[model samples]
Target: MYMVLVRTRVLPGDLLHDSYTGIAPPNTYKLGNKLFSLKVGLVEIDGKDVKLIPLAGPYIPRVNDFVIGKIIDFDAFSWDVDINSIYTAHLPAQDVFGREFSSQTHSLTSQFKVGDMLAAKIIAFDRTKDPVLTVREHGLGKIVHGEPIKLSPSKIPRLIGKKGSMAKIIETKTKTKLIIGQNGIIVVQGPSEGIVLAARAIHLIEEKAHMPSLTNMINELLTKEV
Candidate 1:
C-alpha cells in the first residue's frame, strides 16, 4: 500500500486508482476495480481510501480541523453550529453528557444555546454529510470574554507564520493570548489596547500574506504609537 500523500489538483473523471484499493470515498465513484474522481479537488490518499479537499469555494470540513463555531439551533440530541461554512455542524449530546447522555431528559440548552460561541474540532466529516464537532480536547470549549476576529481560511498558515514566528511576535508585542481556529476564526484575549494592536497586526498579515519577510513589517506596526 502506498503511504505517500498525493496532493495534486484533479478534475472530474480523473483516474484515481486502476485496481482495487478500498471503497471509493466521497467525491469519488468506483466502477468495478477502477476508481475515479467525481469533482475538481485536491486529492489525499488515506491508506487505500481517496479523499478530496475542495480547491476553491466555501470552507469544507476536514477531520481534525480546529474551528470556531456559533450555535445556531438545537434539538434533543445535538446542537447545530454555524462554522461559517455551507452546512451547519453538530455537537452531540453524547459528546457533552458522556455516558449519562439522555436526550429525552438532559437539557441541551443548559449547556449551550443559539448565539453561543465555541472552540471545537471536527471529529467526523464527509462531503455529503454534515460535520461533527467535539470540544473534548484541551483548549477547546466555549469561547470566553475576548475579541473575536475573522479572516479567510486560506490565510491561516501566514497568520501562524513559519514555526509560529508571526503569531509569536503579535503575542509578545500585545501581551495577549491568541486562540486560533483553522477555519478562520480567532480570539484575542488581552487588554483592550493590546487586543486592538493584535487585530491590526493580524489584518495587516492577511492583506500582505503574499509578501515575504513579514516580521519586520509587524515589528514596525507594533512599535508605531496608536
Candidate 2:
C-alpha cells in the first residue's frame, strides 16, 4: 500500500514512497528511509502524494480557451500561428482578423507575414488538421504591445480564475491589458512599471493555483503598491 507520510502536499514531479513495496511511480522514486519526497518539478518539492500540479503557465489548449499567438504565415483559407502551446494553432481564412479574405491568391503571406501577434480563441482541434483557432469576434485581435513576458501555459487557467475574477482584479489594479496564450506566453500593455508588477503578480498566482483562497490573496497583493 502507498504510505501516506505527509498527507497530501506533493508537488509535480514529487516522488512518492510505498511502505511495503519500497518503490514508487516511474517518474517518481523514493530514497531509502527518507522521510520526505524530493521535489523534482520546476518550482517546489513536496513529500506527500497530492494532485498533479502544473509546473508552468498554460501549455495545453482546450477548446474555447483564449490565447495569444504570432502569425507565422497567412493563406487564403487559413493563417499559421506560433501559439505557445504544444500544437500550432490555425486561424481559418474566414476568421481572418478583420474581414473575409478578399485575396484571390491562395498564399496570403504577402499580406500577413511573420511576427504579427493576435488575441484569439481555440474553437476546435481536428486531429487530421491543426487545432482551429479564431479571432473573429470583438475583444479579440492584435493586443496593443507594450512589454512582452513569457509564462507557463498550465498556470493560465488559474491566473484567469472562474468567470475571469482573477484577471479582472489584476487588470483593474494594473490598468494594463493582459493577454494569455495557451502556450505559456503573455502580452501585457500599459504603464511599464505597472505591467512589470502585474507580471510578477500573475507569476505568483500561477505558483499557487491549487490554493482555495488564491483570489483573495491576489486581490490583496494587487491592491498594494508594487
Candidate 3:
C-alpha cells in the first residue's frame, strides 16, 4: 500500500480521521464515527492506516540501544550521564577498566572528566533503576571533537529519514559526517561550513517534522546559498 503525506500539526483532541478511513492507531481516541488525536503530534495516513508521529517527547532507553550522552558528574565507581532522558544513566568504571576495576588504582578523572561527551550503548535499564551505559563496544567512545546539537527525541526518525535517506542526503551535500544518538543528541564533524549547514538542516527537520514535504524542504535549505 502507498502512503499519503500530511503537513498539519496536531494537538490533543484534534480531529484525525473517520472510522471508515480505518481506525487511528494508538494515542488517538474514537468519538462515534470519528477519530481524534490524544497526543501532541503530526498525522500520517499510510494507506488506510492513520497514526500520529509525536513532535515532542523524552527518550526512553531500551537495552542495546546506542545513545549519545554527556558526562555530567562522576564518582569513583561510575559517571553520571545525561542521555536526554528524565533519568540519568551511569557508566561504570568497570566497563572502561574491565571487571577487575580499582577505584583507587584507576582514576576515573584520567579517563573521562565531567563535561566530556561519549557515545554509548544502553546495557541495562528498567523502571526500578536508571539506565546503565557502556562504551566498550566498537564505534562507542569519547567524542573528542565535533559540533554537538540537540533535537526533539521524537523527531530523530525524521532526521534520519526513511532508511537513512535523509541523513545520507545531508552528509553527501554538506560533506559532513553525523553520529546520531537515539537520545536526540547529534555530533556533526567536518568543515566548519558543512557543520553549520548540516546543523541548520537538522533543526529544520525538527521544526517541520509534521510537514509532508519535509525532505524537499531540507534539500532546498541545504542547497541554498549560505
Candidate 4:
C-alpha cells in the first residue's frame, strides 16, 4: 500500500498523498509535472538510502567527462588538461580551439603559446575518444593577468554551491571578480585587500561545503574585516 505522488518524483516516504491520484497494489506509478522517476536502484536521502524511489535532479559530469583542451606546448597543436575525471583530456592544435585551417593559414602554434591557458566549454564526447571543446565566445580565452590558486577540481560543486549562492555571496561581500576553472584553477581579482579576502572565502567554502550552515558560516567569516 505504498503510494508515491504522480508529480512529486518522491522516492518512498516523501509525503506524496497530495501530488498523486489512485491507490497502489504496490504498483509503479507515472511521474507527473515537475517530477521524474528516481529509477536508480537506491540513493542516500537525508544520509541514508533505505528505500528505492524516484527523485528530481539533473545530470552533471562525474568521475570522467571527456573534455576538449587547448595546446600550451608552443610547437604542438595538442596539450593535456584534467577534465574533472580520471582520464586526461587532449586538445590537438587543430582541435585545440576547433577549426580546420588551410596549411597556409596561421599555424596553431602561433595562435597559442606556452604558458597560455584556454577556457573551453564541453560540446560532445565519446569516452573511448577524446572529448570535443569550443571556446568561441567572449568569456573564453587565455587568462592574461590575475593570481591563480589551485583547488580540488571535485570540490567545484561546493565552491559554486546550490543556485550559485555561494559564489554570489563571496563576490558581493568582497567586491571581487572570480573565474573558476573546471580544471581546479581559480582566478580572483580586485583591490589587493579584496582579492585576498575572496581567495580566503573560496578556500573556506571548499573546506566547508558539507557543513549544514554554510551560508551563515561564510557570512560571519566575510564580515570580520580581514
Candidate 5:
C-alpha cells in the first residue's frame, strides 16, 4: 500500500492512487487505471485501499452506531430524539424500559422528560425511513451528569485514536470518563477541573484530527494538564 502524508489536502478528482496500487474506497471513485478523490479532505490509505476522510459533512445515521440524543417530543409509545442529524431518531418505549407500553399503567413522559439526554444505539435506519434507536444495551441509558461537547462527526475516529489509545490517555491524565457518541456528542465526567481539561482535550483532537503526530501532541497536552 502507498502511504500518503497525513493532512494532505485531496481535492475532488485528485489522483489518489493508480488502480494497480489500491482499490478505491469511500469518498473516492476509480476511472480506468486511476483512483480519484470524490471529496475535499485528507487522504487515508488502509492496506490496499484508498479513501478520503471528509473534513465536513452531515451525520448519516447507521445501524449500531452509539449516539447521544436529546428527547424532543413524545407520543403514546415512542419518543422523538434529536440525534444531531437531519433525521430525528425514534426510541420506542419497549426499547427503553424493556416492556410494552400500557396506557393504563405506563407514562412515557414520567420516564423521559423533554430535553433529557441519553446515550443510545441506532437499531435500524434506511433512507426511506427514520432511524430507530434503543437504550437497551448495557452501558446505554440516561446521561445523568456531565458537560456535552460537540465535534465534527468525521473527527470521531481520530478522537478515539487507534484502539482507543488517545481516549484512554485523556481519561487517565484528566481523571475523567469520556462517553463518546459517534453522532458527535461527548460527555465528560469527573471533578470540575478534570472535566474541563478533558473537554479541552477533546476539542483539541477535533481541531487537529488531520495533523500528523496528533496523538503525541494530545498526550503532551494531557501531561501538562496534570
Candidate 6:
C-alpha cells in the first residue's frame, strides 16, 4: 500500500520525490528516480502522489480565466485585445452581442471601438492558436472609468488574501471598489484619493507577498492610511 509523506516546502530544481515515494503532479517533473520541483512552491504529499502549488509565475491563459483587456484592433468579425499575455486575445463580434448579431447591417466599430477596455473571459487558448475571449457573461463588459493598475500575476492570490479577506479590507478602508482580473489588472474606482490609497495598498501587497505576517502588515498599513 502507498503511504503519504509529510508536507514539505521546496524551491525550483529541488528534489521533491523519488520513484518509490510518489508520482509528481503539476510544477514538478520526474527524471530517473527523482521528481524535481519546477517552481518556488509548496509541496503536498498525498498517498502515492506528490503535488506542488506554485507561488510565482507569469500569467498563462487558461479557459474561463476572467481578464481585463484593451482593444487594439478589429477585423470584420472579431476584435483583437491585449490581455497582458504573450498571445493576443480575439473577441468575436458574435460573442459580444449574442447570436442576434447582424453582421450585414451593424458596424463593429460602432459597438466597440479601439482603445476600449473590457472585462472578458478566456473562452479558448492553445500554443498553436491565439486566445479567444468573450464578454457575454454578466458583469463582463466595457470598463468606462476607474484607474487601472498592473501587478505580478503570481501575486494575485496574495492580494486577494484568503476567501477575499484582504480584498474586502482594502475596499473597506480605502472606500473603493476593486475589480481584479486574474491577469493582474486591477481597476480601482471611488473617490480619487481613495483610488490612490487602494492602488498603494495593492502595490504593497504585491511587493511583500512572500513575507510572513503579510496580511497583518497590509492591515496596519491600511489603518495608517485611513
Query: lDDT per model, in order?
Result: 0.83, 0.67, 0.88, 0.55, 0.86, 0.85
Candidate 1 structure, TM-score to reference: 0.75
Identify the leading candidate in terms of lDDT: 3
Higher-scoring candidate on TM-score, 1 or 4 = 1
Clashing pairs in 3: none
What RMSD, rounded to one decimal, does every model reach? Answer: 6.4, 6.5, 3.7, 8.5, 2.6, 2.6
lDDT of 6 by residue, 1-226 (tens): 4546554677999976556344557788878877789998767776566767677788899999999999999988899999998889999999876788878877899878999999999989988999999888899999999999998887888888889999999999999999999998999989999998988888887777767688898789889978
lDDT of model 4 at position 106: 52
Q: Model 6 Cα displacement at 111 (Å)?
A: 2.0
Show model 5 residue runs off by greater than 4 Å: 1-7, 18-24, 30-34, 45-48
Per-prediction TM-score: 0.75, 0.65, 0.84, 0.62, 0.89, 0.88
Q: In candidate 5, what are the lDDT values of residues 1-226, reduced to their tens digit?
A: 5555545788888877765344557778878877888887998665464557887778999999999999999988899999999999999988765665685678888889999999999999999999999988799988999989998998888888889998899888988899999999999988999998988888888778878789889888888768
Top candidate, metric TM-score: 5
Which runs in model 4 stand beyond 4 Å of their true positions? 1-43, 46-71, 74-85, 92-100
Ranking by TM-score: 5, 6, 3, 1, 2, 4
Better of 1 and 4 by lDDT: 1
Off by over 4 Å in 2: 1-7, 10-53, 56-58, 75-77, 97-111, 208-226
Give the lDDT of residue 60 in candidate 6: 90
Q: Compared with the true structure, what per-residue lDDT tens digits does model 2 show for residues 1-226?
A: 4433322455543444434234443234446644233433322324443323444332656788777788887655778888876678878766663464565744566445678777888889755657888777788876656666776666676777889888888888889987766566778888887898898887787667667788888877877775
Worst window of 10 by summed lDDT in candidate 4: 40-49
Per-prediction tally of clashes: 0, 14, 0, 4, 0, 0
Predictions ranked by lDDT, top down?
A: 3, 5, 6, 1, 2, 4
Which is the winner by TM-score between candidate 3 and candidate 4?
Answer: 3
Model 3 C-alpha lDDT per residue in residues 55-103, reported as the tens digit of each score: 7878888899889999999998999999999999999999999999998
Q: Candidate 2 or 5, higher lDDT? A: 5
